[model samples]
Structure formats: C-alpha cells, structure tokens
Target: MGIRPLAKARTSFAATFGGLPSGFWWLWTAQLINRACGFVMPLLAFYITEELDRSAAFAGTVVAGIGVGSLVAGPFGGALGDRFGHKPTLVAALGATAASMIALAYARSPWALIVGAFVVGVTNNATRPAHNALIADVIPGKDQVRAYSLNFWAINVGYSIAMLSVGLVSFTGYTALFWLNGATTLIGAVMIATRVPGRARPAEPTEAEEAAGGFGAVLRDRSFVAFVGAQFLVLTILLQSESGLPIAMSLDGFSPSTFGQVAALNGIVIVAVQLPLTRLYKRFPESWVLAGSSATVGIGYSVLLLGDSAWIYGVSIVVWTLGEIGNTPTSFALVARISPDHLRGRYQGLYQVAWTGSAVVAPLVGGWVIHTWGAGPLWIGCLVVALAAAVAQLGIGTRLTRRVATKDPEEQPEPAKSAPASDAG
Candidate 1:
C-alpha cells in the first residue's frame, strides 16, 4: 500500500511536469545555472560597507543604480526580442552580464563600482523580458503557468544552493563570487547561443497586431498599468528581503555569514513548498490568491516588530517566503495571459519595469527608514505598504480576471497529455 502511494505520487509529479517543449527545458536549465551562480547582488551591501569601508547610505545609492540599469534594460531588451528575436536578446544580455561582472569585480573605487554596478544591472536584468517572452511564445497558454511554476521552483533551488554557499565562500573574499558568477553566466550564454534555435526576426505582426503592438498600446492597457502599480507596491515590500533585511541584520551586529544563513531561509522555504502550494493555489481565484499573498507578506514582516533575534528573523522569512512563492509565478502567468501573442515581448518589458523600478525604490527608502527610525519602523512601513497593495491587487485582479475571460476567447491553447484542466496561475 505504501509503495502504491509512492508510485502514485511519482505519476502525479510526472503528469504535472510533462509535455513542455525541449526549448523551455533548455531555457529552464540555463536559468537554474544563472541563478545558482548569482551570488554578487545579495552581498553588495556587505562588500561596500565591510570590504570598501563605505557608508550604508552610499551603498543604497549604488544599489539604486542597479535598479536604474534594470529600468532601462527592461524595455530595451524587450524591444530587441520583439524585433530581432528572443534568442539573440537573451544571448546578448547574458554575454554582456558576464563581462560586466568581471568589470565590477575589478572595480575598487566608489565611482568605479557604482558605474560597474549599473552596467552589471543592465546586462543582468536585460535577460528577463526576453526570457519570459520566449517562454510565452513557445509554451501553450494552458501550460505556461505550470512551466513558470517549475521554472520558479528551479530558481529557488538554485537560490538555496547559492545562499547556503555564500557563507563558506565569503570567508575567502568577494572577488571569487564575482568570478564564478561571470564564468557561469558566460557558460549559460554560450549554451543558449549554441543550443537554442535562433531567429533573425519574430514572425511579422499582422496589420492589426502591428497597430496594437506598439508601446502606446501597452500604455493604453489601463488594467495592466494599474496591475503594474499594485505590483510595484508589493515588490517594494517583498524586495526588502534582498535589500533591507541584510542591512538590518548587519546593523544588529550580525556577520555576513549569519546574514547568509538567515537569507537562505527564504529560498529554503520556497524550495520545500512552491510546487505543492502551486497546486493548492490554483484552486483559488487569482484575485484572492494575490491579495492574500500580499497580506501574508505584510503579516510576515510584522513578525520582526515583536522580536530581535535570528530565530525571529528566520520565522519572518518563512512566512514571507510563502507569500513570495505564491506571488512570483502567478504574477508572471497573469502578465502572459493579459498580453497579445504578437505584443508579448513589449508587454512583458513594461511589466519588468515595475519590478526593476521597485528595486530602485525599495533600497533607498528602506535604508532611510533604517538609518532614521531603525529596523522596527522599516518593517512597520512594509506592513502598511503591503496591506495597501493587497487591497489594490484584489480589485485589479478581479477586473483583469473578467477581462481575460471575455477578451481572449479566440485563443486555443494546446492540449495537455494528462495534466489537470485547472488554471495553474
């Protein structure tokens, strides 16, 4: 009976993951490698303060520059993908990211590091829209959620490994982290450039599609624009895990290794529950799921106001990580659903802007809050912002759901082999 149950679980897992294209798997593999080797960004605050003896405020500025780069990269790369091809955009971004990482590693002065960080941020984030667009292009709409969910799972698994390794590697010095990050990124780029099929141009948009595919059309999407705003607010809160949380721990006398341990909890929790939760979350409406996720994030961060220990931090991480797991793939899937086939790259680019823009905002504000009122106030602010975003998302999500149901009836998604018919997003 136990063996039967185990076999049934295996069958269920296979059913859930089966029927994705070879291209998506290749992209997935590359993303996993890129994320595992993505070690530099999270440690930047420490490197600036501990290694270079810089101020937290200065570190915030440098981090803000990363967001600025990402802000430009989102639309630019998406345009490139739409015009030239997703493969070329992805390859170019990855290769540029590798070079920038090396440049950033060698940079010693404040001005040099800031410039390098901006360049690195551009090259690194330029991959997002193109990568997402390609997935949408190749995968059927029905499977996109599952594909994204699996990809998100792979990302966290890699993140877990990377965060866990940060402690051991930091004792050696930050230089190695940059070098390994560059090497692996370059390898992933090469793999994609060689393995993935390259197209000189995407299929030409129809007359109507051409008219609808411009940035103006994307801007005219009132629901999408509002969604982006709500997303921006939620991201401002969630991204603090990367930007503010570590800085707070450091201010509290925590070492880099200690910070790494606590940070790793985010990825660890995601790794354990993302897929199972994906299955569960699909049973609920996206509006409720996303709104609830934001509220959950607010509640999680509020845990910090009650205590000041690593255990408390760990507990906070576990709660917020659950929100992150729910939000990330669902948000991506929603963006894909809202976009037209020909304008996918453009729509995805603007969506990327919301995230990158928030990355810019979160650190500056978080640093100020921490520096002025301390960590308690910062977390309190997160709670308030997150709850507000939740309310906004619920309303927006409900509207979008109605729009998606009525608007895209012509779309005939490919049939799955044995997968459940539920909308996984």
Candidate 2:
C-alpha cells in the first residue's frame, strides 16, 4: 500500500489522540502515569508501620532499597539508551517497574519487600535518562526548557491526583494502592511503546569526541563535575521533604492523614505555580535562576526549624515548592545544552545518577540524624548543604553561560527554515 501523506496522518492522529508529535504526548503521558503510580511512597511508610508492624528504622531501610536499585541501574541504563535506543529501553523498564510494583503489593517478608523496592528503583531510574535523552534528541534547543517545564508540570499534576485518590484506595486496602500503581505504570509502558518515536542517531562521532570517551568525557569536564556535585547536594536537601517531613510531623503529634496532607501540598503548589512562573524565569540566566532557587529552597527548609505547627509546615512546603519549580527545568536545560548530541543519553543518565545516588543515601542519613540527634540538626544540615550547592552552582552556571556566549555565532547550526509540519507516522 502507498504511504499516506504526513499531514493527513498527523490530522487523523491528532483527531484520535488530541495531539501529534506522538513523541511529546507519549513522554508527557508516560510521566503522568508513572508519577500517579509513584504516589504510593508516602503511604508505603504507613503501610509498613501501621499495617505490617515494621519499625520506623526498618521502613526507612525499605524505602532506601529503591534508591539503591536506582544507583545500580542508572549508568547501565544510560549506556543502553546510547547503544540501542530510548523507546525500547523505556518500554522494557516501565514493564519491569509495573511488575515490581505488583510484587511489592503482594510482599509479606521483609526480604520480598526489599527486593521489590529495589526492582522498582532500578526500573524507575533507568527510565529517566532514556526519557530525557529522547527529549534532547527530538525537541529544538529554544523549546527544550519549556518542554521540560511542561513535563515537570505534568508530573506534579499526576502526583496531585494520585495523592487525592490515595484516600479512596485506603478504604479498599493498601494492597489495592499497589495494584493501582502497577496498572498506571503499565499504562505508561503501553503509551511509550506504541506512540513515542525513537530518537535518530547522529551520523558519526569525530575521533576527538570518541577518544575523549563518552560519559567519561562529561565526567572529566571540571564545570560539569561541579554541577553534578551541586545537583547531589540539592537533591540531598529535597529528599528530606519526602523522608524527613513525616517524621517531624509525627513528633509534633500529627497523624498519618495530616502527613499525607503536607505531602499533597508539595505537589499542589508545584502543579499550581510551575507553569505560570516558567516563562517569567526563562529570560534569566540559568545560573542565577538555579542559585536563587536553591537559596529559596534552603530558606524554606530553614524556616521549618522555627516551629512544628501545621501552618508553619504548610508555609515551608510552599517555599520549597517554589524553589523546586525554579531549579528543576533550568538544571535539565543546562545539561541538555552542555551535552554532545551523540552522548546526550550518557550525560542524562549521569545526571540521573547524581539525583538517585543522593536519594538513596540522604534519607538514610536524614532519618538517622532525626532519630539520634533532633530535627533541628537535620534541618540545619540541610540548610548548609543547600547553601553549598548554591555556591557551586553559581560557578557552574557562570561557566556554562560563558561557554554558550563565546561559541562562534557562525558555527552554530542554522535554524530550521520551517517547523517540521507534523509529527506523524
């Protein structure tokens, strides 16, 4: 059969699916579904502590298992994305994640739970580098920041809906939450496998580029390395919002439901504010934006030390959410800008590692600090980390902006004469 016209194909596809560039929709939908499924983590501590009769320390260990899996899988996942392609790897990882979630629902023994958490972590981390690299491949340079911002907004929307829905599932049972989580992951997998276009490989790598060593080259770049360290610290502080906040709430006489509200507030603020402010901030240098955001987040967390009241906690959430919105997209844009086209997957994967590695260790350390010393010490430590990250990012961001500015304007690729009219099969 003769191939249909691209425009006709796009029109039909848009009519059926509500958009074309199936790639963009696919990525956004996958994020939405994956995040919706991920809403279970906040509840997982409750399930293990209240339902399964596990200790706080043990529950923290279980949660950390996911991070461990992610760290283990991250580099290899990025390499796979570079070697093969993002679409297939993402589909397979999502499928694996779904299975892991289902297994987690059924887990009775601690070992089973740990294994399930690890699998989920690994698959979850693996999906990100591939997803990010694919976006770099498909989206134009000027549009990339907005695209990542939109993706972040979609994630929060999904998370907000999931948090709201979790109350209904609690009535059914905790296992039901796991099942729902698994189903959502499956939906993401299906969407990506069927709809997302695969990334096109570049013609070839130059000898110098190849000899410099793929991901190794990225690691070797001094400024990039600093940026990664800054990212690590930023995540170290942010992860506390997930692991430390609940403990702080409990110590102040709040119940599990109240803790859930606090968590939901984090998502709600991100969803409500991220898109509106993204455009406003886009004009600023990314370095200033990142430093300002990190400082904002640090200030927010520091404010938590002032009191344990619900309103105080709520205010803290709002502050951190704003900082989060400011930092996330800009950071990703910087990474996309610095990476060579052929090694984008590898760099994205490495970026995932910085965040994931922190996620694994930060909670364990934060939990221990809270258990042994006090919330004050933990929050104080977080503030210090944030300040350090801001400082490091200032330097990194300055270097990145300078690199972009100094590049020969004539050597830059000419803008595409016209937008590729349609993203159709």
Overall lDDT per candidate, in order of appearance: 0.83, 0.77
**Which residue runs of candidate 1 sit more than 4 Å off their true CA positions?**
43-64, 105-113, 166-179, 197-200, 247-258, 370-377, 407-425
Distance (Å) between predicted and true CA of 386, model 1? 2.2
TM-score of each: 0.85, 0.82
TM-score, cand. 2 vs. native: 0.82
| Per-residue alpha-carbon lDDT of candidate 1 for residues 123-163, written as tens digits (9 for 90 to 100) | 88889998888777777666766778888988888877776
Leading candidate by lDDT: 1
Ten consecutive residues with minimal summed lDDT in candidate 2?
A: 416-425
Off by over 4 Å in 2: 1-22, 39-61, 103-110, 168-179, 200-203, 368-373, 405-425
